[model samples]
Every structure is written in structure tokens, then in C-alpha cells.
Target: MDKIHLKGCRFYGYHGAFVEEQTLGQIFVIDCTLLVDLEKAAQSDDLVDTVHYGLVFETIKKQVEQHKYKLIERLAGAICQDIFQEFPAVQAITIKISKQNPPINGHYDAVGIELERQRP
Candidate 1:
């Protein structure tokens, strides 16, 4: 299957387990890989033949910025669900969400989780 890679999508959201995190909010970085067949799109050379990444970005933005979740796992799930629902051309998705400064007492670049989901 062909792939569409949308990486380094950053958003400010209030999603965390801690009170300070939900109150102050933080930056969340997302990387998404959309699995789809691009043969028709390649032949047609038309935007309609493939998924509109700009709209996909908007969908992700709404989920990240407008809603609050206690866990990044749930957030990841929501994103996958929305993407699959909004785009029928997408067969599967792999999403990674990173929290830059998680409320943890440790020295790390970032803490994150990755999820892969397929259409049923």
C-alpha cells in the first residue's frame, strides 16, 4: 500500500493526568502515517483521487486543541477514529503522540506512545 506521512504536527492542548497539565496545557507533537492505495491518484493526478492532507491536518487539530483527555492513549484513539471516519480512502493509520515536558521527574527528550489502527 502507498503511504502518506504527516509528521511533526504540533498543537497546544490540555491533555494530561495532572491538574497543572490540564490547567496550563502543553505542546503535543503528532506524527501520522496514513495507509492507502495511491494508484488511482497517481494516474489521475487529481486531488480528489487522494486524501486531502490539509483537511486531515484540520481534523487532527480539532481533536487535539478542542478536546481534553486524561491520557494520550485515549487521545491517540480518538485521532485514529476520526481519521478513519473522515476518510474512506484511508485503510489504516499509525499515529504517535509526544508530550515534550511531561510531569515526570526525569531527563528525557520526550515521552510518547504510538498506535496503529485498521479499518473494520
Candidate 2:
């Protein structure tokens, strides 16, 4: 299996269990890694045979920015599902979502959740 990774995508979103968090919003960072078979694309050097990374980035951005969720778990799951649907070549996906300066009364650069899914 071959891999494609996208890291350090930052966006501001109002997602949290707390009202203050929802109203104020915070910076969220997203990372995605996907498993794919690169042999065909590598041989043909055709965009059609391979996944369009721009579209993947846009999908991740849209999923993160356009919707509200109380848990990163759900957000991550939704992203994986969307990617699987959008890119049939994606055999598996791993996504991580992080919020910097979480309201948990601790000094941390970011708090995050990571999950992986394989196509069924």
C-alpha cells in the first residue's frame, strides 16, 4: 500500500461542549493520511487514475469549517467517511483533529483525537 499525507491544516471552528467555546471559537488543526495503490498512477502519470489532492484538502476543509460538532471523534469519523466516498482508491484513512489551548485548564499546545478507518 502507498500513502499520502496532509498535515498542519489549520482552521478556526466553534466546536466544543462548552457554550463559551462554541461562541468564541478556537483554532483547530487537522491532519490526514490515506492508503492507496499508487502503481497505476505512477505508471500512467495521469491525474484521472490518481486521487486529486486538492479535492481532498477542500473536502477536509469543508467538513471541518462548515459543520459544528461537540466531539472530535464525530468530526474525524465524518471526514473519513466522506473521503472514502469521494475517493474510491482510498483503501484506508487516518484523521486527526486538534484544538489549541483547550478550555480544560491546562497549558497545552493542542489537544487532539486521531482515528483510522478502512473501507468495507
Candidate 3:
């Protein structure tokens, strides 16, 4: 299947189990791959036949900003659901949510979760 990929989309938000982490916030990077048919868009050369990347980006951003989750896993799942519901043409999606410089024991730049989902 063909997909439109949005890689390394970054945002600063409050999300964590720790109080400092939530209050201070941190950088989050999201990467998404959306699977959909492109035949109609390709053949007709019409924007409507294809996914609107801007709209998708905004939707993701809006959700991320509105809600805070302790787990990146949950965030990614929510995003997947939002995308699937908002855009029925999408047959599948892969989402990765990352937190930079998390307060871990060792030196680690980031931690993340990746999830893949398909239309039912």
C-alpha cells in the first residue's frame, strides 16, 4: 500500500507522570504514515481526491495540545483513532510519539512509542 508520510513533526507540550515534567513540559516528536489509495488523485490531478496534509497536521496538533497523557503509547493510540475516524479513506496508519530528554536514570535523549493500526 502507498502512504503519505509525515516525519519528525515536533511540538512542545506538558505530558508525563512526574509533576515537574508536566509543569515544565518538553519537546515531543511525532512521525506518521497514512496508507490510502492514490489512484483517483493521481489520475484526476485533484486535491479533493487526495488527503489534505495541512488538515491532518492541524488535527494531530490540536489533539496533542488539548489532552495530556502519561504514556506515549496512549497518545499514539488516540491519534490513530482520530485519524481513522476523521478520514475514512485512510486504510491504515503508523504513528510514533517521542519525548525528548525525559527524566530517566541514565543519559538518554528521548523515549518513544510506535503503533500501527488498520481499518476494521
Candidate 4:
């Protein structure tokens, strides 16, 4: 299938296992790979033939900024579910969520999780 890559989506959210994290919040970077068929869009050359990436970004932004969860996993799941519901042409999605500064005692880059899901 074809792909639509939405990368480097950053948002400020209160999602973490620690109370301070939920209180102070932090930055979360998300990348999404949407598996879709581009044949219709290629032929029609119309916005309606494909998913509106702007709207999709807004959907993701809403999920990230408006809600609070204890885990990024749950946030990822919510994003996938909303995307699937909002965009019928999307067949599958691969999402990566990274926390900029996690409450860990070590020197390293961002840490997070990636999840891939298909329409149910």
C-alpha cells in the first residue's frame, strides 16, 4: 500500500507515571505513518480523495493537549483510534511517541514507544 508520513509533531501534554509529570507536563513528539491507497487521490487529484493531513494533525493535537494519561501508550492508542474513526481511507497506522525529558536518572536521548495498528 501507499504511505503518508506525518513526522515531528510536537505537543505539550501531561502524560506520565509521576505526579510531577502530570502537574508540570512536558513535550511529546509524535510521528505517524498512515497506510493508505493513493490510487484514487492520484487519479482525481482532489483533496477529498485522500485524508486531510491538516485535520489529522489537529486530531492528534487535540488528543495530546486536551487529555491526561499515565502512559504514552494510552495516548498513542487514543490517537490511533481517533484517526481510524475520522479517516476511512486509512487502513493502518504506525505511531511513535517520544518524551523529551522523562523522569529517569540517566544521560540519554528521548525515550518513548512505537505502536502499529490496523483497522478493526
Please give the CA lDDT of all the candidate structures. 0.96, 0.88, 0.87, 0.97
What pairs collide in candidate 4?
A: none
Q: Which stretches of candidate 4 lie over 4 Å from their true place?
A: none
Clashing residue pairs, backbone N/CA/C < 3 A, model 3: none
Where is model 3 more than 4 Å wrong at Cα? none
Which structure is stronger by lDDT: 1 or 3?
1
TM-score of each: 0.98, 0.95, 0.94, 0.98
Instruction: Determine the C-alpha RMSD for candidate 1 after optimal superposition of all C-alphas.
Output: 0.5
lDDT of 3 by residue, 77-120 (tens): 88888998998889999998888788888877688888999987
Residue 19 displacement (Å), model 1: 0.7
Which whole-number lDDT from 0 to 100 does residue 7 have in model 1?
98
Residues 44-72 of candidate 1 have per-residue lDDT tens digits of 99999999999999999999999999999
Instruction: Give the TM-score comparing model 3 with the true structure, all chains together.
Output: 0.94
lDDT of 3 at 72: 74
Error of 3 at 106 (Å): 2.4
In every candidate, how many clashes are there?
Answer: 0, 0, 0, 0
Q: Name the lDDT value of residue 93 in candidate 4.
A: 99
Candidate 1 lowest-lDDT run of ten: 111-120
Better of 2 and 4 by lDDT: 4
Q: Give the TM-score of candidate 1.
A: 0.98
